[model samples]
Target: MLITFIISSALLTLITLAPLLPSNHWTVRVWEFPRLQIVFLILINILLMALLIAQDLGPFLALVIVNLCLLCYQINWIFPYTPFANTTVKMSKSSDLSSRIKVINVNVLMSNRDAHKLIALVEQHQPHLLVTLESNQWWQDALEPLHDAYPYRVNYPLDNLYGMHLFSRIPLSDITTAERVEQGVPSIHCIANLHNGKQIQCHFLHPAPPSPTENEESTERDIELLGLAREIANKQGSDSLPVLVSGDLNDVAWSPTTQAFLRISGLQDPRIGRGAYNTFHAQYAFARWPLDHIFHSEHFELVSLSRLSEIGSDHFPLLTEIHLK
Candidate 1:
């Protein structure tokens, strides 16, 4: 029994290392999805090893050491998301309420038929801009009431899970629907003119995840992020306008791809000092990571960010308020 336990711990350690390879295959890419689970298992394995340590002193000690090493590595990846880490974006202390803009993002799971909860949330928040993904014609009709309050709209309501719709009460100009990396997947890009006479370039995306049911590899997802990052990078400047990018990114905030995108685009995540605010798999708290993201350039400071109530979807809506600096 002791030998079997040791082998099990060693196997878990190897599984944690599999993601270190440079392969984008679904099997390898998926390792990034369960870091939290791996960390938990590592801890439990260590405690079990301690109880069994008296059985085989040397071997069990080695097992505990290995688990500790893996635990440190996993924690290092996730520590920046806790309040202990410095925030990537400065918090907004500006008292100018007019300069503040609130944006809400929701991935209304395509198969979810109920829209009453979603509609209610909209009525309650009444954000300056509301972005929705995986919305079909049915959703479009159900959300028609938005047109009354939100005069400006950019919509691509398709049965495809990648459909996107942007509703804004503020002025939206130069709106464009782009199929940057894949045809079925669409992204919304436009300029949001704030009441303070400032323009915020906005981009909303929902890239495909690496799963057996979806793409077999993460190449498309990686490419889509890189392309968007490059576009944002090109626009980076000292006197450039503020830019906001948000949606169900379908990737963890701590993944290499996400970090690389931040470095390339020079955008900041408000969740650095804040908690994970993990939005995906809303029903499973322990199994959640930050999949829905809101990233912005240095031109804006954080006001408030939180995960709103569920809307019969797998993801919880993300609400972020920022003040242009």
Candidate 2:
């Protein structure tokens, strides 16, 4: 019984972490691989445990081979090859970066009290562009001091979970809610004019989380963002303007769909070599992952990226500085 319990717990742990495995096989990965492999292993374990309870050794030993294969395949998680890994290869050729830009993204839990923490973080980072998710009128009021620092603002603070506010030191032109899906669930799309006369088309999004309370299915949000990413990729192959799509994607970086988003969008993940800048579940440090992200087109270079201190919310603020060449 003890051995059965041990095997069951181990298998459950493996299943949970399975999705974080690397997916650059040029074959199959993440959802298609890990999720399938995990389900198969869990069933096998259950069958083997039942056999063991019945004093059946033959089936248990046969299941051992399946367990071994699953364990071996699990090694892909040791290193995830994201676009950030590709940065070094292109660095030598990017020597003519003219101007730099800084961006900060945060998801302040709608009912959080540490509004001052976010305010201080903005003051400290002094980012050129800032985006806050799950914000309401209360949050907007708490962060009012930032209005002076960032003269140009696009505030849409609503009680709904989709509320988002964007503050930028640079001039934001043609500011409007992106019409990817429908109303209520808002996403900000704007063209930012930098001090260097360069302009970047930016998309700040907060997709619905795949939880029972928020969103029952993730299809709409996933497809909406993917469609946006695909549009950006089409532009990337022709245009010179920098493009960035950022916010809490609510999906793991190593997921198969996210990999497809990368393949389809042609955007680069900024957290490859930097390690997982886990920024959720602030109260429990161990229960966090890099839900917040900043993916950019090839027209920019990363200057710096950081996860700010806890702001009494469920997520930590992500600050990124980049230079356009």
Candidate 3:
């Protein structure tokens, strides 16, 4: 038992620290998604080691210490999502009706056909803007009901899972879509009108995740996100508009690449000090992470962030309300 615990504990400890290297290999990048699960494993392993202390006291002590360190590193990255941390975007203290904007982002699992669930959410929340990922021609037809309410839209539906669609009640101008990282994987860039007649620069993305079925490495995702971040940060420097990027980022909020993107873009994450707001794996409680995200500039203040009811898709809808300060 002691021998087994030591070997497993040591291995887990190394896996936990793998992402720290400046590498985007699939093996290293994949480690970014399971920090929370690793923490649980570390805790349980520590308890097992303590109970089996009779085997090799010295080795067990070293393993326990390493596990503890790994635990701290993982928690530090996630601490921003906890209530104890301070929020990056502050909601307006005043009841400013004209400056408010509501946006919802959802990733409709490509194979799932529950269009009504998503349409119902749009009706219930009445978001100023709605962005959908993994959308296709059928999903577009199912969502036709939104046209009456949201006259302005940009749709790029495809049978491939990388499809995207955006609908807004407010006018959308300067709209364009691009395949930032790989061909056929499009990202939307546009400007939306706020209640007070202000223009908010918006960018929506659904970066391909690093997986065996998809790209074998995180290179494409990182390049796409970071490249856009640099551009947004450049325009954001003028400080004339409130830049907002919302969609299924396909990356966790706490990952190193995500943090680097934020720093490069100078965009503020509303999830900071709020909560994990895990949107993926709607069906599984054991395996989940905050994959969908809304990152905006410091020009706006956060109002409320909440997860909507399950829509039969693997991801639940995320609703965010913000006040343009």
Give Cα distance to truth, residue 203, candidate 1, Å: 0.6
- TM-scores of the candidates are 0.97, 0.79, 0.96
Model 2: per-residue Cα lDDT over 137-206, one tens digit each: 9998988889998999988888987789999988999788864664677889989998768899899988
Candidate 1 similarity to native, TM-score: 0.97
Tens-digit lDDT track of model 1 for 1-325: 6778778887887788888998999898788877887899988888777776667668567777888999999888888899998888888889998888999999999899779998898899889999999998888888997799999998899887988999999999999998988889999999999887889999999999999998999999999998899988997788778899999988998888999999999999999988888898888887787899999988889999999999999999999999998
User: What is the per-residue lDDT of model 3 for residues 1-325, given as tens digits with 9 covering 90 to 100?
Assistant: 6578768877987898788788777878888897778888888887877776756678567778877888898899888988889988886675987788899999998888889888888998899999999999998899999999999999999888988999999899999999977998999999998767898999999999988898888899989899998897777556568889988888999998899999998899998887899987999988889999999888888888999999999998999998888
Question: Which scores greater on lDDT, model 1 or model 2?
Answer: 1
The weakest ten consecutive residues by lDDT in model 2 span: 24-33
Per TM-score, the best of the predicted structures is: 1
Full-model lDDT, candidate 2: 0.72
Report how far residue 204 has shifted in candidate 1, in Å: 0.5
The C-alpha local distance difference test score for the whole of candidate 3 amounts to 0.88
Clash list (residue pairs), candidate 3: none
> Residue-pair clashes per candidate, as listed?
0, 0, 0
